[model samples]
Target: MHISEGVLSGPVLLSGGALAAAGTAIGLKKLDYDRIARAGLLSAAFFVASLIHVPIGPSSVHLILSGIVGLMLGWGAFPAIVVALLLQGILFQFGGLTTLGVNTMIMAAPAVICFYLFGRLVHGRRAVALPAAFACGFVSILLGAVVAGAALMFTEENFLEVTLLIVSAHIPVMVIEGMITVFCVAFFRRVQPDLLPGARVADMAAPQERNEA
Candidate 1:
């Protein structure tokens, strides 16, 4: 959901930039040095995923694995997403520098929200984790669409139709993302259970301890 360079009004741009700045600070602080590698991989994944855009209206539809990033990286998703978005803007000219902050806020805010909302359940037992994973990915996109649409509408009255188009076009995308998240969650649970949201700091260490016992 890129807002382009000049589409947003001055106040709207300022609001997005301010909020994104705050989120980046918190994300940087919350991110541990140990997770730098994980963050990098996920950032690259998001960068690739968001590039395949299907034009809907003023915005476009794409596979944003925002929930997957949030589920794994927690608050780190904000900074992670920003870095990828920055490169996309600079190199590929996907969103542009001026709209970088807004696009980051649009994508990463919902990610953080889903992290808090579904993170625990996804880390829980099997019965709940699978469903939670699906919901996390599904709901994040829906919420992100809403925020993107609202951001556009707040800038001007004519974007009401565009806002509607954004939401409607993404409905299918939500389902696709939900399934992808579920598959990834399940695979990680089997191969690297500790990496999936339940554990962070001692993820690998915990498995070693159990094996040693």
Candidate 2:
């Protein structure tokens, strides 16, 4: 979902960059210093995850485990995604710097939305959490594709073709991401349940609901 440097006009690029900066600021303010180390580790994991490419049909896709990041980190997914994408761009030239803001927003916004939605739906149900997490993972990837489509539409008349290409390419990757998120959430539940933010929220909410009842 990377838009090359010259694809976007100056106005769109500047506006996107400004919005991305604002979002990053908000993400940083919400970030806990205690969580910084963990977020960094997850960012590294995200970086590595995207490198393992799987060819699907006429295109290639890679594991994005964004749902796992969102589940664990909450709003912190923004900066984590930014950091990972920055590294990918600088080191691998996977994406260009000029379009970094757009790319980050495309991936991270859906993650934040999925985090909140999944957290709400899976409250108090560990059994349902994995499936919800998988759905969130799949949806986040689809949302990224939509964002890419929108961006392309604004700039190119033949954007539908590009959108279809992206969506088709990501289908297999989304499935992989979904399975990985489910397994990761389950494994963490078994090994270090406290590490998951959604679990903590559910734990806190349960007692209040019980007391009110």
Candidate 3:
């Protein structure tokens, strides 16, 4: 969900900007060269998935697919999300420049959180991994909605209704994303387990032999 530029107060905007900067810095530091393409691909997916959205007051509702991003990129979600959001703002004007930081924080924060929460579970048996995958998607949306709501609330107390509406509107998306995550995770586990979080760089490349040596 993208929060409109003028909707947030100066202090709120500054705070969001600072948090985003810190997250992006950490994300960049932790990002592996081997995974750059993966991050770019996920960012593109996020950008496309959110292109079709329904505006609700200052925010919007759409498919974030953030769970998959987090599962695949972990801390790298910050930089990936920031890039997608920046492109959306510059190209389509879906979100404005001034609000970029807040919007990025709103979406990426939950993604990073989900990676920590459910990343390992996805590596477990089917019974555990499936539910964990679903939760990763479902909870990321829920948390994102809450974060969006909080930003609005902090901006102005009168936006309570809009905040409620934003959260309520995203309920269906939460379930849809959860199922999408489960399917994606299942597919990746079969064909490309190395793409998931915690996959070693050695595993990503050909451990048998590498030009890096």
Report the lDDT tens digits of candidate 3 across residue range 1-213: 678868899999999999999999999999879878878987898788766674546776567888888888899999999999889878988877778888888889999999999988898899999999999999999999999999999999999999999999889889878987999899998998888866664375765567566
Tell me the spans in candidate 3 whose CA falls farther than 4 Å from its real position: 52-61, 201-213
The C-alpha stretches of model 2 lying farther than 4 A from their native spots are 54-60, 202-213
Candidate 3 to native Cα RMSD, angstroms: 4.8
Where is the poorest 10-residue window by lDDT in model 2?
119-128
In angstroms, the error of model 1 at 27 is 0.3
Could you tell me the TM-score of candidate 1?
0.87
**Cα-based RMSD of the predictions, in order?**
3.7, 3.8, 4.8
Query: How well does candidate 2 match the true structure in TM-score terms?
Result: 0.85
Expressed as tens digits, the lDDT of each residue in 51-90 for candidate 2 is 7776667876667766667777778888998899898888
Q: Give the count of colliding residue pairs in each prediction.
A: 0, 0, 0
Better of 2 and 3 by TM-score: 3
lDDT of 2: 0.78
Error of model 2, residue 35, in angstroms: 2.0
**In model 1, which residue pairs have backbone atoms overlapping below 3 Å?**
none
